[model samples]
Target: MSKDLLTVSLDVYLGADPVLCEIVPNSSCGDVDSEDLEKQPKRSRKASVKSEDISRSSASSRARHDPVSVLVKGGVAVDPSLEEPLRSNAHVLSELDTVWHVMLNQTNISMNSNKFYLIQLLKSDTEDKYWVFIRWGRVGYRGQTSLTSYENKLEEAKKFFCDKFLAKTCNEWSNRSSFEAHPGKYAIVATKFEVPTKKEEVCKPEPEVLQVSRLDWRVQSLIGLITNLQKMEEDVLQLEYDASKFPLGNLTREQIEEGYRCLKDIENAINTKKFDAVFRDSVNRYYTCIPHDFGFRAPPLIKTQEDFKKELLLLETLKDIEVSYKVLRSARESKDNRAHVDRFYDKMHCQLHPLERDNDEFKVSMVSMYLSLGHGLTHMFSMEIVNVYSVYKEDEYRRFKGSIGNSMLLWHGSRVSNFYNILSHGLRIAPPEVPLTGYMFGKGVYFADVATKSGNYCHPSNGKCALLMLSEVALGESQVLYDANYTADKLEQGKNSTIGMGRKDGVRVPLGPLEDCGGDGGRYSLLYNEYIVYDVTQIRSRYVVEFNFRL
Candidate 1:
């Protein structure tokens, strides 16, 4: 095997963000020459006479930008001296030839006048021209993107960045408040690749506080289940066995332990009852950040009665699955006879089978349950279904949010188009009315109906009209406000709008009569997207499914 020896170079901008005002790099110790400063046009006699006044004014301005700079003027070494690379040749030859290797000229700004801009220069032997790259982003996002530019000479390229640096400084001064409002909008420059050791060490919003309320019985119950889950995880980790043949066929005991650990973390989040924190923590375990292009935020957590209720339902389902696992684990641990174990396995398998068809999260949970139960029994009794079920289970877990970039990938397979199908099929029975809610896993246009109390009596036999026609813009499109008068033309106008307003992490769109559906007059013709059709009669019935969809 051979490794590519590609050189790389970075000009990073780091330090308090770009603020207007000129505090040129003070290379007083060495390196810069006096001729550099002297190579400038002389000021007029009038300007020269007022140089003292100008100096005082500039001092006042510098003090406003940085108080420490005021101390620096009084002979204190407040800022660290600029350090140069050991060799100039090494610096010039270090340009990375490959594209998108992470290291690019980036900048980080901190207090005490540490803000600066960098220009990356990459040498291309084949093209015989150096490639220029600069970091660009909005006022306050860590989402600095490396943009490519052309330059015939290195000095010109450096000058380009210097100019950009000045412009950015002025822009920063004008938009400092804007930058402060957006978290993780600045480009963070680091000396070397390092992992964050603390939560606040990284650029992110502070975690919201959790409050346990007795008014919500589900929260109380979830807290108890979380405590039990923690204990179970500890027990699983303490298990001593030869994991080399663990699961007896698929995952080692270590692998199973890892899954347990992930489950425990999620359970802890549930116990917090802090909706926002739970959603962020749960998704972050699997994704670095939500794609900015999607522009949609993770649904808000715990903002309304409906929001809490939905969370309660989700937690309840998770608790039920977890409890079922405990039963199977106990049976296996007791070394029950083959017949007894088989009975337990069959019973549990039937219970989990329906869940496998639910949303991605529920499906992943079912997989985890099967893996733990199957592996424990197989390790103890040399079972045979280990390979088959273990493979299926592992595959499902991989598709979940916690499993390494799984949430960002394109899922190419059958999608759950109907929300009602998931609830009815998952629970194994349909109720008179089940209030259901879930997140939008993939982007596309969807048609749904929200059951409302207004239509319960007026037209009893009219049936359910498609109250809201929802459309998820592009993959990178952000979720927008509810547009009651949204039309397919507006969608083409490049604005992302849904039929309903967001409720925490779910959507709640009001249902009104549609003219095309032959109900009382209301606008529904504009709801049509690419195609307009009148087929597919209204699905009216007593059993209605209330929707809470999050994009």
Candidate 2:
């Protein structure tokens, strides 16, 4: 990392009396030796280095020939080549020079200006002569070179010139005497400032391009405008800070306000108009002011680039949606819209099929649903073992341990007519609709009818109904059967007793309830307990089942 830098003002030196050392032609300047420079008081590291190098070399070189005329301006070496008139390539001043480059209003000192004054001593590299260089111009500008050589009384002549320059440049001072009268009129203020690295040092990443199809032109223009405005804001802030550090730059608060005004105008333009209408050439001039490479790899610009990319993607998606709508409208109006509309619809359906298909089906909690209804497995069937033999090459049939004929029998399924409707209506507990045609021989007919009829039984309050059927085939059957011996006694009693006759079994039994019954015997069991279903649906069935059994 680099060391910290300090900013100083040029006015601070104006009050100091010019030192007039007699200049002897062909004679060297009695600059301080290295030992003396190291002893001198200093604040900047670069300044100390310059002073040390010059002091160390001047003494020994001076002893060999005529001592060189050395002048230390702001603790830096006086290289005439580095100053104006010679086009010096050397890094003229140390990075630590505390020169306050100022811009002065030639007509008024109180007002801000861009005109600055600079003075330097130069030694001729080709000719054995010395010259003084003085200039007044804008900062970062090389207006013209003005040179004056001092052959005799050089130091005195240079002092007179310096005094005259300060008097003319500063509007407050009419002459050298007035400046001396009020030395404190101009105060020196110091502040922190950063010197940006050279452009070559900064890494530049590849520029990102947004490929928005329909609105590419509009989006690109808006992005370009936003980018330029953002850069202008940064530049203005830098100039403001620079002005504070160097009073001569004449960077005032007014200039900063102007920059903010420029940014606001661009923002207003973006918000008020459609992006397509923001293509004014005058506003486009901001593009020229921005750096081409933009240092996209830099931290500040990285976030800026990402924001632009996101905006581009959003615009692109919006454009796609709009185009899709247009295409749909055109398809509706055209007669031969099969190619365009049908293909589009097909592609859309394909994309949406996964979400819509079987979405109504859900895991059926048979345990919870059955328990809520006070119903459960009526019988747990035990498996019966059967032996089989296989005939091979031998005539006699012999049973082998590995090749025994085995038969697996699945149980007959039971159907609860109204219960199926409730479960099928709620998707949370409904299983996938199963094909009942070949599920279990003739048992599937009743199961298939229940599954189809349940669709209309959906109740809104209770979400979707789930199927109470299990995934695997049931392998059990109920064992409730009517006794043949009791049937003869029931028949004899039915023929002799009247409608109100009490049964001989002790308890009085009602007879008219089943008197008009049509005998269509399939399967039946006497219910021993009452069953109850919760209020998840409107109907809360709680009644004693006359004859119910799971088979």
TM-score of each: 0.19, 0.19
Candidate 2: stretches off by over 4 Å: 1-74, 77-114, 124-128, 138-144, 151-153, 169-237, 240-551
How well is each residue in 220-280 modelled by candidate 1, as lDDT tens digits? 2322322232222222222211111111111222323332343344444555655454444
Single out the weakest 10-residue window by summed lDDT for candidate 1: 52-61
* TM-score attained by model 1: 0.19
Candidate 1 displacement at residue 390 in angstroms: 6.5
Best by lDDT: 1
TM-score of candidate 2 on Cα atoms, chains taken together: 0.19
Model 2 Cα lDDT, one tens digit per residue, 463-509? 22111221111112111123212122132321211111111111101
Candidate 1 wrong stretches, greater than 4 Å:
1-122, 125-128, 133-150, 158-185, 189-293, 296-551
What C-alpha lDDT do the candidate models reach, one value each? 0.24, 0.23
